[model samples]
Target: MPERAPHGTSPSHPSPEAYAALESLLRASPRGRWFLAEYARRNRTAETEMLLEAIARIERAVLKPAPRQAVPSNV
Candidate 1:
């Protein structure tokens, strides 16, 4: 039997890996990339933008600036 989603609730957000896959697929085809971006923008889906924003935030968080190592003092 197929599992059902809880009533009045949708599935949770996709994983970062899944979102990265989707972004990669979209970029694979120029036309598809353009269309989805335009459609998503036109529809004004906060969810879509939020997902993209989350991805961006995740990327930044994962790749923060590294602390600079101090050089040895010259004699």
Candidate 2:
């Protein structure tokens, strides 16, 4: 039978060396560069949209427009 991993740790997670090797391989290829760019763009767009939505909600809830004051009547 295969041995189990220690408590709080899993075999599915890659070690640091394995992760570094994979990162170097990805950084070395043109297609990988394109993939990384697209991933970053998508992540940035999602974050921007969420921020905009939060700002909108805050404006609606806390930033009410003030009432205009009436102009003084001419003598």
**Which candidate gets the maximum TM-score versus the true structure?**
2
TM-score of each: 0.41, 0.59
Stretches > 4 Å off in candidate 1: 1-7, 43-75
Q: What's the lDDT for candidate 2?
A: 0.91
Clashes of 2: 0
Among these predicted structures, which one has the highest lDDT?
2
What lDDT tens digits, residue by residue, belong to model 1 across residues 13-59? 88999999988988899997898889878778877788899999999
Where in model 2 is the C-alpha error above 4 Å? 1-16, 64-75
Error of 1 at 51 (Å): 20
**Model 1: residue 70 alpha-carbon error in angstroms:** 71
The RMSD (Cα, Å) of candidate 2 is: 7.5
lDDT of 2 by residue, 1-75 (tens): 987998999778789999999878988999988888899999999999999999999988787887898888983
Residue 19 Cα positional deviation in candidate 1, in Å, after optimal superposition:
0.4
